[model samples]
Target: MSDFGRKGLGDQLKEKAQPDSTKSTLDQTKESASGLYDRAAGAVQPDQNKSATQQLGDSTRSTKDDASNQGQGILASAQETIGNAAQAVSDTLQGKK
Candidate 1:
């Protein structure tokens, strides 16, 4: 009947329509954490032998250092690829006629 009464009813309807907003946010957070874990796992390959802290022969230690450097290089390459893709998209949008 009154404007205030109608406004209260509208607010109640909105609340009832979306009761799982908090659950959706928690699910998104879990999904993001899972993705981060997977990425970190992929970055570190499985080493059959001891870690870098363990003492090893010169050749073996050098090989390990090279592998570590290679991993960093790969990360740089992936970053560059992502940057190039973003730049391409930006250029395409700006070049639109």
Candidate 2:
């Protein structure tokens, strides 16, 4: 099971947590391009007017977007949990909790 191109959970979480300001220029450009393409596609072909194959493509894209969003949410929750644990430990050490 080579995971070559796929990001590991830690990497994914780190990426999700990274501030937009710190993203590479290339990454930002790519995101902008993707957004533009999506907007153009939507304007050109509203959902109800798509062919069967186009509808399938749209569905696949939607599913992928949904999964990515869910992954980011999970990562945020994990980061919050870890931060809270760390804070609790610090407070205990300082006799504040």
TM-score of each: 0.37, 0.59
Maximum-TM-score candidate:
2
Give candidate 1's error at residue 97 in angstroms.
Answer: 9.8
Tens digits of per-residue lDDT for model 2 on 1-82? 1122222334434555888799999987876675556536744666677655556655665787899999999999999999
Q: What lDDT is reached at residue 22 by model 2?
A: 96
Worst 10 residues of 2 by lDDT: 1-10
lDDT tens digits, residue span 38-73, model 1: 334434434333233221222343586699999999
Residue-pair clashes, model 1: 0
Query: In candidate 2, which residue pairs get closer than 3 Å at backbone N, Cα or C atoms, i.e. clash?
Result: none
What lDDT would each prediction earn against the true structure?
A: 0.51, 0.65
lDDT of 2: 0.65
